[model samples]
Target chain A: MSKEWIGKTSNKVKNTVDRLLVKRFAESIGDLHPIFVDETYGEKSKYGVNIAPPTFPRVFDYGVLEGVDLPMKGLIHGEETYQYERPLLVGEEVYCYTIIQDYYERKGKSGDMGFVVIKRVGEDAKGNIIFTEIQNVIITEAVRKGINV
Target chain B: MKTMTEFKPGETLKVTLAPVSRLDLIKYAGASGDFNPIHTIDEEAKKAGLPGIIAHGMWTMGNLGKLFTPFLEKGFIKEYKVRFAGMVFLDDVLTLKAELAETSGNDLFFNVKAVKEKGQEVVKGSVHFRLYDAV
Candidate 1:
């Protein structure tokens, strides 16, 4: 595989947070926190409205992968990290962009493998970043065989 | 686990998560747009040489996030990171074992890890958070 994806960035994608989206995400993870799903509970909370789960931003569209095409079939999610400025609020709009932060190769028990690190940053309309998520993806040779030519 | 204000170093907060089911995986796939066959498709997972359908890494992470939701509601979590140490299969009972590593003024740092009933480590990470003093 070519190491040409380093530093590549995607176009900005817009996403809106709402009660249904927030509730569904919380339910999906079986986290039925009242702050996320109960309207009355949220109305009295400090955030003034229902809030999204901490990982709700994962559902945000970070545009398309502009670079680093790989056979995703065998891809492995190696790790993930998130830094938050504040908990995301329901009914807020956030714009996000994805970037290929780094790429490297190493030998593993399965043979040679490549690791790609991608980052996505979400910001409010005023351009203040609300949160950033970094994910590490591993691609193995066996998985590469499934890639379409 | 007691309130964050009373948290002490060497103290541990233990939480047993609900068993992760195939339906949960499907719901997560629909909500998160992950849709990875390794997470939702049994035959595709077998073809990939996996034991069976595995839960999405973020699903485990989100479960971990639940542990701190209370703290987040009262205080604030500045950062959270995790390394996917092992796979979580269907019907796995995950336990979150978190220990406070240190405390500096209002900042509390802790090391958190998740494991199955059989003691297989699934996720390991650390969290840094700040507590708000009541007025």
Candidate 2:
């Protein structure tokens, strides 16, 4: 029953940075830039092709953590980050996966709270990193108890 | 919001958005593939012991990028990190701000934040951008 939850990585999940996904994401955040939607403008622009927004990669599948189970409900997204080597070009293929970077518990106002730091990476076909994200989630006492963590 | 080399360390950019709505969360969920009920259904949120449906933390963080939208031609966001200080409920009007923290060659550091109408800082952190054409 030892829950050593660091460095647990997921299998790579392949995804395409398509136009529709990028457009929806751009519009959803209410930051619809021409580079994310208008093809004509994008073609004439610096990149010569439509490019996804900086934060668009948040939508890609980063696979799942193996042998770790936690309640999805009652968990708070405490912090998040996105570090990009470059923006993912539209229609480009990316492989993503997640790693449990660290896990610990702390005393909070409501009681015991658990902090889970997960690092998700997106790489190109050559295995070069395009971006990496570290997501910090706050799990409630009940969630910790449920998982016996 | 100065472009190119005109940006200085103390320069700042601000964008005040409309109130957060149920549809905003719903749209964000669909676009981001995060279907957690606590973000969309009020009943589900109550069952989860929340006041009501809360906005996804990423939703608010994503909107913070708006402060740099006009300056894209000059650079791109190389890093964005933030802590969710408070929950975002419906009808919360968020004010996004970015102040150039420093400059190093082509890289520009910015202290970014989002504040609720009531003056609560919901999200706060820094962003790093690399200019395409730098001096």
Clashes of each: 0, 0
Worst 10 residues of 2 chain A by lDDT: A1-10
TM-score for predicted model 2 compared with the true structure: 0.96
What is the fnat score of candidate 2?
0.75
lDDT of 1 by residue, A42-99 (tens): 8999888888877888888888876457665778889888998888888889999998
Q: Interface RMSD (Å), each candidate?
A: 1.1, 1.1
Docking class of 2: medium
Candidate 1: pairs in clash = none
| Shift in Å, residue A73, candidate 1 | 1.2
lDDT, candidate 2, A27-81, per-residue tens = 9999888877889988887878888877788888888777878677767888889
RMSD of each: 1.9, 1.4
lDDT of 2 by residue, B82-130 (tens): 9999989999999999999899999999999999988999999999988
Q: Which candidate tops TM-score?
A: 2
Candidate 1 residues lying further than 4 Å off, grouped into runs, are A145-149
Chain A TM-score per candidate? 0.92, 0.94
**Candidate 2 pairs with clashing backbones:** none
Which digits, one per residue and each the tens of the lDDT, describe model 1 over residues B28-70?
A: 9998888888898899999989989999989988888787887
